[model samples]
Target: MTITVSNLQPIIAILAGILILIAPRLLNYIVAVYLIVVGLIGLGVLRHFS
Candidate 1:
């Protein structure tokens, strides 16, 4: 199986939804981390490592 940028968003959203449902208090941290990760990926910082 292969993963691509186009396919990552929904997977991340689903996971985030589940996490928020399980622990509402973690919403802030989860969103912050998700944004940071997405930003890094967008900037191609993570592509090199992968």
Candidate 2:
């Protein structure tokens, strides 16, 4: 029942997919946010906060 860091991406992906299917217009924002988050993770920017 625990939500670990490793479990986040797939969860987010599923939610994003669902959201996109429900509202196609949100695809742009969803992708933009996902990319920004991933880029920040890649740069280790969010590591300090965790």
Candidate 3:
């Protein structure tokens, strides 16, 4: 299936979940990175749609 912008969040969530499951210690870093990335997206700093 094609990966559109809408599909990116869930895919990332799934991957993050798996990573967290494998290594619980990564929770802090994962959350921090996720928030930063999402914030950048919201601010149009990272344009996946363009």
Candidate 4:
């Protein structure tokens, strides 16, 4: 199984949103990690074609 771009954004957004909601104090860390992960994936450092 692979993950396509179309399927990636919403999941990431929801997860980040949840984390931010659950721990408002962790927003910075969560956003940083989320951005890094998504950036790597977007840059093709990681690829999932679902």
Candidate 5:
């Protein structure tokens, strides 16, 4: 199975927003991991999406 970039981008943005809003303390870690993972996925460095 695979997930398209267009499909996952918005959801990732929304989840990041919610997490930042609901738990300010986790913003750093959440954003860091999100950026790292998304960067890899976007760059085609990894292909685990499904």
Candidate 6:
């Protein structure tokens, strides 16, 4: 099973949703980190790692 760029966002969203539901206190940090990581990925900074 391969994960493409198209599959990344929804997966992240779903996971974030679950995390937020389980721990409301983590909502802020989770969203901030998620945005940062998504931005980095979009900008190709994390391309090499993938």
Structural similarity to truth (TM-score) of each candidate? 0.78, 0.82, 0.82, 0.63, 0.67, 0.73
Could you give candidate 2's per-residue lDDT for residues 1-50 as a string of tens digits? 77655678898999999999999999999999989988887788988423
Mind sharing the TM-score for model 6? 0.73
Candidate order by lDDT, decreasing, is 3, 2, 1, 6, 5, 4
Name the regions of candidate 6 deviating beyond 4 angstroms: none
Whose lDDT is greatest here? 3
lDDT tens string, model 4, 1-50? Answer: 66677778798789979888999999989888878877887788877532
Worst 10 residues of 2 by lDDT: 41-50
Q: Write the per-residue lDDT of candidate 5 for residues 1-50, one digit (tens) a residue.
A: 56677788898889988988999898899888978887887787787662
Cα lDDT over the full model 4: 0.80
Selected candidate, larger TM-score, 1 vs 6: 1
lDDT of candidate 3 over 1-50, digit per residue (tens): 97766778898899999999999999999999989888888899888742
Give the clashing residue pairs of candidate 6, or none.
none
* Model 2 alpha-carbon drift over 4 Å, by segment: 1-4, 48-50
Model 1 per-residue lDDT tens digits across residues 1-50: 67776777788899999999999999999999988887997888999523
Q: Is candidate 1 or candidate 5 better by lDDT?
A: 1
Winner on lDDT between 2 and 5 is 2
**10 residues in a row with least lDDT, candidate 4:** 41-50
* Model 5 poorest ten-residue lDDT run: 41-50
Q: Listing every candidate in turn, what is its Cα RMSD in Å to the true structure after a full C-alpha superposition? A: 2.0, 2.2, 1.8, 2.6, 2.8, 1.9
- The stretch of ten residues in a row with the least summed lDDT in candidate 6 is 1-10
For model 6, residues 1-50, the per-residue Cα lDDT tens digits are 77776777788789989989999999999989978877898898999534
- Candidate 2, residue 12: how far the Cα is off, in Å: 0.4
Which portions of model 5 show Cα errors greater than 4 Å? 48-50
Off by over 4 Å in 3: none
